[model samples]
Target chain A: MTITITAFSKSPDQGMGLARDTRVRWALEEAGLPYEVRLVSFRAMKQRAHLGMQPFGQIPTYQEGDLVLFETGAIILHIAEHHAGLLPNDAHARARAITWMFAAVNTVEPPILELVTARIFEGDKPWSKERLPLVHDRIRNRLRQLSTRLGDADWLDGSFSAGDLMMVHVLLRLRLSGLLDEFPNLAAYVARGEARPAYQRAFADQWAINKPAAKAR
Target chain B: MTITITAFSKSPDQGMGLARDTRVRWALEEAGLPYEVRLVSFRAMKQRAHLGMQPFGQIPTYQEGDLVLFETGAIILHIAEHHAGLLPNDAHARARAITWMFAAVNTVEPPILELVTARIFEGDKPWSKERLPLVHDRIRNRLRQLSTRLGDADWLDGSFSAGDLMMVHVLLRLRLSGLLDEFPNLAAYVARGEARPAYQRAFADQWAINKPAAKAR
Candidate 1:
């Protein structure tokens, strides 16, 4: 059975690959798995059937044969587990790689999300200006700690795995904030991830989808 | 080798079971794993050695023999993978369960964390009050989607697994915001999770460490 996934019809990011589907797409491309994309409008997303695939009614749901999965982290993980390249063969290294995947989403992404909230959704608020600095500081604080640990290392653990894939996606959100540039090492680290062929393929694929619409606008 | 975990010396939650360590403790209790808790002061967490164990320098890093892992999602996953009960025996089902776990952390928790950032960190911001409603709406929107899908379903999947444990914990953060009350089903759902004997045991065990100080306050 063909694997099918859903993504935003017109991503708010203008196909910069910030969408969660980009991660899933990147994983699929890395695994050399040919899949189909099902673009969904924001309206259709809240529908009953769509909500069944995603309880939170978010995009990038994976469906293969009888199995259906939601969440980019989960979808990428499933691909990584079934495919060879996304994880390590060594037992300990595999466990550590999985740990970094969780860190990327759980620990690092939270503050970045706050920055987004401050910028887009809360931009009109009176305290948006004052609160923006605090959100930035929180992100910087996390980045400083992470930079210190990642010092002089290419990846969070030995060899890149799904962990780095997720981490790069998380850090890419900070690109607009300029917080990533503060740590030269971290900035270079993210650059390395973006430069990956898999990431490039994913970026181009999504960008192709939105390019026409952006031009029309 | 025994596993060493880190936790707050005195939880600021004051035994309310809001601490991240409680999640690790709950998972450990459920796994029937014997572990040691190393109380960490906020100052010590920023140190080099401790940061080595946890890149983000947060509590609840798992150290068993030579293996070290951080991120509650990763630690819980490591525990669930090593043990039996936290995952399903069926390969596909297990993968889906893992996906829900990621969704809990990556999707659901982001908005709740936004509420926290707004009220606690950005409370002093001039636009804090105006931004609060937007944050609440974002959370409510996610909750509504979740509630609609969860309609009468006891769990996100077949049986209670680490996914539910993570999801329940993520939803628990909304209790203080009163947003949970907007969705009666989700509020009840969280209660169901809290009612679990394993969850109770985990709560009590961690609460014991902070009970005296809670009394003092």
Candidate 2:
């Protein structure tokens, strides 16, 4: 059965692929799977129907026939589990690939989110100027450790899997911060993921919708 | 094969069982699996060996034979995948259970962590009072959505799975704020999870180690 997922009617990111559905879309595109998107306003997201699908009323919930899934990690993992090209065939390698997936979301993304919060939500706070450098340093610490581990390797692990997909997405959030430039190898790693034809298609698709909205305003 | 997991050499929470390792311990107890804990200091968590195991320099990493896994969601999911009782037998039900696991971490925990940051890290700030409500409201909004979906339902889905384990743990963070008291149903839901003997045993085990440290100080 074909799948359907949800996204912001008007994404806050303005088509930067930071909306997370971009990752799902990119993954599906990479897997050569066609899918549908249902736009959810902030209001509709909290409604009974949406809450039935997503406990926390967040975006990019996946549905296939009677099966409904939420949480970007879970949704992406579900897709990778049922589809090909997203995971390796070997058992040990596959486990390692899944490890990377967890690392991306659970490990890498937290500091990035902290950076976002400091910049966006706490921007006006007096301490933001002082606090941001600490957050940036934390991010750099993670990047340095990751860069060290990933030294001279193309992907975090062997041949790209869902883990690389997630790590790339997590790292992409650093683009505007310019901190990514500090780690050229990590920057190139993100570039490699973005350069994937599937990623390009997904980016173009979402960007197509986003650019016009920006223009109208 | 026996499994080895990490815990705080002395938890900052004293005996409160708020530490991440307690979650893994609870999962292990619930699964009726035997395991050992390797208490690590903050310094050890950042050391090369620990960093090799956990990229984020956090706790509750799982090690079995040659397999090592980090991220509580990933670890719990792995345990649930290998052991029965943590997942439903039906395919669709299983997917939904896993979805809740993601929701607990990605959606619910972020706002709760905000509350932590505000209360602990930025408590001295002039804007702490104003920002605290915003963080609390964000948490309440999540709980409201969750409470509405739960209604009179005992568990999030059919049976108690690792998903519920995660959801309960995430919700438990709000206990001190009394915001959880605002949702009696969710509070009771958390109570039920805590009442589990497995949870009790896990709590005591961690507490046994943590309590003395608090007293010594």
Candidate 3:
């Protein structure tokens, strides 16, 4: 079965590969699976067709034959579960890896997401300047804990798994904020993730679509 | 293997069962698994021992034999994968169910968490009153999409899988805000989740620990 995943017709990030689709694409690349991309405009994402596939009407819905899955974590996990590279063979190790995956999204990413909300959506608000520091502080708190746990480790757990993939992507959002630089280990960690052959391929694939040259074409 | 989990020594919700441990307990109950709970105080949670088990220093870490797991979604998923009731048998349905679990935490809960942050942490800010409507509007946007998808369905997908278990728990947070009532189907969906015997048992168990009378004892 050919796997088909969705991406933004034109990513708001403009080829930075920060979009959620990059996560799914990276997972597929790691799994060595061939997949196709279906681009959806911001408008179509809210329409009945796309909403049927993704309840939240978000980009990056995964489809293979009769199976349709949304949410980047789920898509990545599904790919990881079916393939060998993305998860460990040991049951306990695999469970721990999955735990890291959840921790990345639920515990760690929420604060980082709040920083995005503070900067983008509420940037012009009267309190944005004052509230921005608080959001950054909260993000730093999480990063501090994460950095402590990660201290000099190559990946989150033993080897690179979907957990690391998800964590690196979540941390990528903080790059522009300069918070990621505060923790040298985490910054190096993100660099390592980006250094992966799979990640590079995935990044280039999305970059083709959102690149200014492609837009001009 | 004896399954042991951790909970707040005294939940901030005061027995309302909004804590993450409640979700883990609910999953265990639905799976018909008997487990033990170890309560940890806020100060103790920040100490080395608890922080070792949970890197983020949050409650609801699961331990069985040599395996230790934190993050309620991961714990519930671990239980559901090992046990019977919380997931479906079909592969595709199971993937979709897990998708909802991620959706609950990643997509749906983030805004709800923002609401909590606005109300509890930022309530004293000069911009609290003015900024709240923006936060509430963001939540309403998600609820609108969710309510539209739910329509007349009893669950997000079918047969009351882990997806419903998670989505219901995420929506439960909105009850105090009165936003849930705006979407009648969503309100009824939460009611159905509450009516479950497993959920009821989980609720009562936590209530026993955090109830005022029990706290006095």
Candidate 4:
């Protein structure tokens, strides 16, 4: 069955590959799956059609035959479960990897998201400047723990799995904030994830779509 | 294998069951699995021993034999995968159910968490009163989308699965905020979740541990 995933028609990231479709695309590449993309405009995403597929009406909904899945973590896990490379064969190892996937999103990403809201949505607010450090410190606390756990390790656990994929992408959002640089090991880890052939392919695919030149085409 | 999980020695919620451990306990109850709980103090949670089991230094870590896992989503998923009640047999339905789990934590809970931070952590800040409405609106936006999707349905998807388990727990956090009351359907949905036998057992279990009388005893 051909897999179809939705992405922002013109991503807010403007080809930076920070949009979540990059995460799903990267998972598909890692799993060696061929998938098609259906772009949805910001307006259409809130409409009935897109809302039916994604309850949150967010970009990056997955469809394959009769199966439809949203949530990047779920999409990646579904792809990983069906494919060989993205998850470990050992049941315990696989469970541990999945734990990391949850940790990445639930524990780590929430603080990073607050930083985004601070900078982007509430930038002009009276508290924005004073509150910025508090948000950054919250992120740093998480990164400090993560960096300590990741010391000298190549990936989160043994080999690169969906956990690493999710963690690396979550850490990517911290790049512009310079918080990632404070943790050298995490920065290196993100670089290693970026160095992956699958990630490279995924990045290029979204870049092609969102690039200024491609818009003219 | 006997399953052992951890929770806060004295929860901040006092007996209300808003903690993530309640979610895991609810899943175990739904699965008809008996488990043991080990309570850890706030200081202990940040110590090396606890951090070894949970890198993020949070509670609700599951240990079954050599397979140890943290993150409530992953733990509940592990239990649901092993048991019958928490998930559907259909592969597609199962994937969609897991999608709701991720949606609960990633999409919906983040804003609610921000509300918690705003009220508890930053309540003394000068901008708390002014910025709260913005945070509340963000949550309302997500709930509005969720309420629209739910309509008259009892659950997010068909049958009560881990998705509903998670979404209900996530929404439970909103009760004190009064934001949940705005969405009558969602409030009823959460009440429906609380009314379940499994959920009732889970709540009573935590209440036994954290209740003021029990603490005095």
Best by lDDT: 4
Residue A92 displacement in candidate 1 (angstroms): 1.5
Which residue segments of model 4 deviate by more than 4 Å? A213-217, B213-217
* Model 1 chain A: worst 10 consecutive residues (lDDT sum): A208-217
TM-score of each: 0.95, 0.93, 0.98, 0.98
Docking level of model 3: high
Per-model CA lDDT versus the true structure: 0.86, 0.85, 0.93, 0.94
lDDT string, candidate 1, B41-147, tens digits? 88888787888788776798888988888889988988998897799999999998898799889888988888887778768866667667888888888898778
Q: Candidate 4, which CAPRI tier? A: high
Per-residue accuracy of model 4 over B30-87 as CA lDDT, tens digit each: 9999999999999999999999999889999999999999999999999998889998
lDDT of 2 by residue, A41-89 (tens): 9899878788777767778888899888887888888888888999898
lDDT of 1 at B42: 86
Q: How far is candidate 1 from the true structure (C-alpha RMSD, Å)?
A: 2.0
Per-residue lDDT of candidate 3, residues B1-217 (tens digit): 9999999999999999999899999999999999999999999999999999998889999999999999888888999998999899999999999999999999999999999988888999999999999999999999999999889988888889888998899999999999999989899999999999999999999999998763444
Q: Clashing residue pairs in candidate 3, if any?
A: none
lDDT of 2 by residue, B1-217 (tens): 9999999897877778888888889888988999999999999988989988887688978899988888887788778888877899888888888878877887778778778877777799776776677678878988988888788888999789888998899888889899999999999999999999999999999988988533454
DockQ of 4: 0.90
Clashing pairs in 4: none
